[model samples]
Target chain A: MLFYDCSTAPNPRRARMFIAEKGVEVESRDISIAKGEQLQPAFRAVNSRATIPVLVTDEGTVLTENLGIAAYLEARFPEPPLMGRSADEKGLVLMWNAIAEQQGGAPVADALRNGHPAFKDRAIPGPANHAQIPELAQRGVARVAQFFDLLEERLNESPFIACDHFTLADISTFVFVDFARVIKMRVPEGNTATRAWYEAIKARPSAQI
Target chain B: MLFYDCSTAPNPRRARMFIAEKGVEVESRDISIAKGEQLQPAFRAVNSRATIPVLVTDEGTVLTENLGIAAYLEARFPEPPLMGRSADEKGLVLMWNAIAEQQGGAPVADALRNGHPAFKDRAIPGPANHAQIPELAQRGVARVAQFFDLLEERLNESPFIACDHFTLADISTFVFVDFARVIKMRVPEGNTATRAWYEAIKARPSAQI
Candidate 1:
């Protein structure tokens, strides 16, 4: 398998941390997002979406989304499962992961893309360029603040976002929370549960990458 | 299982169709989104997110996300699986499904929420209200158009979005494309592959509900 990675991006980092945790090796290709390499013809041939963290499988199938890559890797490398082991665990893993993506990841992107002048006309992802809306930045920031509280509430109830085991839910959430630094958001000082959870995930060796 | 449904919303419709396809009958409670029922304190207690299509599992776990409900149902009733039977198929199913949700579903939502007056201050889904950005609606329409091209390209390659099977990928794409009508967008006349795929999914009995 060949993994298309972007060291600076949150989505690719999620895949990277997952791959590190599983101890699986894949030929890596770096696509610098800041250099506009993802939109280049070479990368476009691999994924028309023009997104990073693509996994080209041994069978020649290209998995463009993180969920696909994770599922395939988990299936192939099951010793240290990052998704989940049981039916209930799988459901919770997917659920929390989606929540982290939508509530946390999306808001961070919104706050950055819609607010930053650097992302002017490039608010939305993909091949098309979209003009930013300043108003969206405020909304994004507000949503992210709420997301931090939600993370705290969830963490207070369970050890990990999904439950006892550290699964894909934690990986995605950890990456998103860490990437939130770009939007100037962090685990609030009062959010002890979320702060502790973030620290725990950060201490993991897989997070070093 | 008790399924909280909304006949008008796309997200809930995905779960409803999945349930219909599986032939697993759950006691359905219609939460009319048009009536702001999702925001009621009663529904808020079920899901803090205040979203519809929540499944109260037999074990009393509240499955809030569509993936969660699908995973739970797929495990309990494996026949005519909406995800996939094999590992490779599951990976492809999830991969395509995530693309459908992010690329297709999110765009339709952006178009509607950002443009429609009824959705004013509700641009983003969740417990909080977000003001609409008219500019985002235009960007959304453009993104949806690109999503259509992507769909056309994918459908031309395989019988279904993920491949030969009609799985969660097809369900999500179908619901999002159909919901795009509210934003005054539909499959372009030139996209024959996408048009045919739409017709095929619509013909399914599950789509009727």
Candidate 2:
């Protein structure tokens, strides 16, 4: 498989970390968002959406989204079982992962795209040129704080976000929590449970990658 | 299960439609965003994020994300297999679902939350208060258009967004496409393949609910 990645982006980083977690290796190509290479014709041919973290299987099938890539890798390498094993476990994994994406990942993107001057005319992810909105960043900061609170509440109840094991939900949530630092949001100093869980997950070899 | 829903919101509608598609009967309570009921402390107790479309399971588990509710429902009622049966199939379902969430749903939300005057001082989800950004709406419009193009390109190659059969990806995509109407954006006029697929999916009994 050939994986098109962007080192700076959170979404692609999720995929990269997942692949590393599964102990799988693929030919990696950098799609530099900093230089706007994703908008180039050569890259557009790979994905019309002009996004990164695309995985092209040896069969010539293109998987263009992070969840897709993660799912594929999880299924192919089931030893670690990042998604989950049983029916209920799978459901929990999916649930937590979605929450992380919507509550955590989305807000980070909103803040970055709307606040960062580097993305001035590229608020959206595709090839199109769309201007930024600085106000969204302020809102994003508030939403992210809430996200941290939500995670704290969840972590207080379960050792892991989904099942009792470390799943893709953990990966997504970890990335989101770490990414929150960029927006000047931290896991609240008072969120003891969340901080402990975050430290534990961070120590995982997969997280280091 | 009891579902907290809002008829007008796209995310809640996706969960409602997924339950409908699964042929499961859920006790649903409408949390009116227009009325600001989602901000009530009563609702916040159920979901700290204060987002709509939360599912309270028989086990008293409160699932707060659309994908979370869908996952739980699909697992509980597996006869229809909304995710998929095989590994590759599962990967495709997850891939397309993420694409729909990121490309279709996220942009629509960016447009609505940032553009709508109604969401002023409530730009982000959760109990916190934040203001809106009108400029994000313009970027949202452009991003949503690009999303349509991406969907059209995918639909042109396959009957469903994922594989040959209907799955959660289709459910999510259908809700997103239908919800885009709120922003006055419909599927592009000339995309015959997408239109046909949309009609067929729309005809499903689940879509009406």
Candidate 3:
């Protein structure tokens, strides 16, 4: 399998951290986003969407999204299951992972893309150029602040984002929260539970990447 | 199993259609979003998110999102599978389902919520109130138009969104495309392939509910 990744991006980092946790050996090619490499014709040919963290399986099927990459990897390497073990667990894991993507990942992305000058005319993805909406940047920050509160609430009750164990939900949350640094946001200092959880995950060897 | 649903909502309709396809008997309770019933104390006690399409399993786990409900049902009833038949197939199904959610579902929602007077102070979900960004409404309309183009392109090459057989991916795409009506968006008249696929799914008996 071949993985197309960007060393600095959050979405790709989630996949990178996931692969590291799984101890999988796959060839990697880094596509630099800062250099606008993802928009290049070569990358577009690989994924017309021009997104990174794409996995080209041996069957030549190109998996374009983070969930796809995580799902395929979890299915292929079931030993250390980052997704979940039982039927109930799988459902909850997926639910929370989707929450992480939708609630956490998306807002962080909005704050970054809409506020950053580098992303002007590129707030949305794909082969399109959408001008940044300043109102969206403000909205995104407000949303992220609320998202942090929600995570703290969820993490306080459950040891992890989804449940008792570290799963893809945690991976997704960690990546998003870490990326929130770009927006000058972090877990509120008073959110002790979230801070503890963040520290624990940060100490993981997979997080070193 | 008990399903909490909103008849007019797309996400809930996704579960409704999936359950119909599976031919499973699930006791369902309607949570009316139009009346703001989801915000009531009783329903909030069930799903604090105030979102419908929640599945309360016999095991007493509340599956809150479309993916969670779908995963639980697919696992419990594996007949005429709407998820997928294999590991690779599952990955592809999820990938497309996510595309439908992010590209199709989200944009349609943005257009409706950000532009509609009824959704003022509710541009974003959850307990917090976010003011509508009129600019986001325009962005959403543009995004939905692009999403239609992408769907048309994909449908031209494949009979189904994910693969040969219908799966959750098809269910998500169908629901989102249908919900686009609320945003005054539909498949362009010239997009024969998308129109054909949409019409075929529209004929499904499950769609009637």
Candidate 4:
């Protein structure tokens, strides 16, 4: 199997951490997002969307999104199930992962892409260039603050993001929370539960990558 | 199982159609998004996110996102599988589904919410109110057109959005294509491949709902 990754990006890190947790050995190539390498013809041939964290299985099928990459890996390596064990658990894992994407990941991305000069005409990621909206950048910071509260509330009630055990939800949420630094956001000092959960996951071997 | 629905919304329709295709009997309650019923205290108690298409399982687990609801239902009823039959197919299903969401569904939503007067201070969905960005409205219209092209390209090569058989990807893409009407967007007349694919899915009994 072959993996297309971007070392500094949060989305790719989620896939990287998942692969590490599963103890899977796969060849990888990094396509630098910082250098605008993803928009070049070579990367576009691999994924027309020009996105990273793509997995090309032995069958030569290219999985372009994080959801697909993680789902395939979880299915292939069922020993240490990171998705979930039971039917309901599976549902919760996906649901919470969606929350992490929509609530946590999105606002952080918006704040960076819309507010940063480096992303002047690149508010949205893809093969195209989109102009940034200053209003969205301001709103993103506010929403990110709310995301921290949401995480704190959820973590206070449960040992992990989805349930008592570590799962895909934790991986997704952790990456987003950690990536919040790009927007000058962090788990608020008062959010003890979220802080504790973040510290615990930060200690994991898979997260070290 | 009890399902929370809003007949007029595209996201809720995705869940309704999935339930219909599965031929499962689920007790449902309509939450009028037009009436702002989702923001009511009662609805907020069920789903703090204040979104429609929530599923309260027989086990009393509340699923607030479409991904979670679909995953739970698919696991419970494996027949007429809407996800996929194989590992690669499953990955493709989700990958295309994400594309439909990011490229199709999101742009359509942004155009409508940012351009329509009815959505003033409601640019983003969920519990909070956010003002619209006119720049995003213009960008959304352009992106929606590109999304039609992307679908046309994919459909020309494959019968369905994901693979040989219909799956969750088709359902998501179909709903987004149909919802483009709200933003005054339609399948371009020259994109015959997309038109044919859209019409085929439109004929499905599940889509009629």
Q: What lDDT does the true structure give each of the candidates?
A: 0.88, 0.83, 0.88, 0.91
Give the number of the best model, judged by TM-score: 4
Q: Give Cα distance to truth, residue B187, candidate 4, Å.
A: 0.6
Q: For candidate 2, write residues A1-209 as lDDT tens digits.
A: 99999987888888888888888879999999889899899999998778888998767778877778877777678877887776557667887888788778888887988888788877668766777767767767777888888888889889998978888899899988998877778898999999999999899887776
Fraction of true contacts retained by every candidate, in order, equals 0.69, 0.69, 0.54, 0.74
Per-residue alpha-carbon lDDT of model 1 for B1-209, expressed as tens digits?
A: 89999988999999999999999989999998889999999999999889988999888888888998888788778899778666677789999999888888988898899898899989888778888888878878888888998899888999998979899899999999999999888999999998998999999999998
lDDT of 4 by residue, A1-209 (tens): 99999999999999999999999999999999999999999989999888988999989999988899887887777869888887788889999998999888988998999999999999999988898999889989999998998899998899999977999899999999999999888888999999999999999999998
Poorly placed runs, candidate 2 (over 4 Å)? none
| Winner by lDDT | 4
Ordered from best to worst lDDT, the candidate numbers read 4, 1, 3, 2
For model 1, the superposed segments whose C-alpha errors exceed 4 Å read none
Estimate, for each residue in B1-209, the C-alpha lDDT of model 4 and write its tens digit.
99999999999999998889999999999999899999999999999989888999989999878889888988899998888777888888888988898899888888999999999998888999999888888989999999998988999999999999988899999999999999888999999999999999999999997
lDDT of 1 by residue, A1-209 (tens): 89999988999999999999999888999999898899899999899789988998888878877898888888788878777666777778889999999999998999999998888888877888888888878888988899998999999999999869899999999999999999888889999998898999999999998
Question: What's the ranking of the predictions by DockQ, best on top?
Answer: 4, 1, 3, 2
lDDT of 2: 0.83
What is the overall TM-score of model 2 with all chains considered together? 0.90
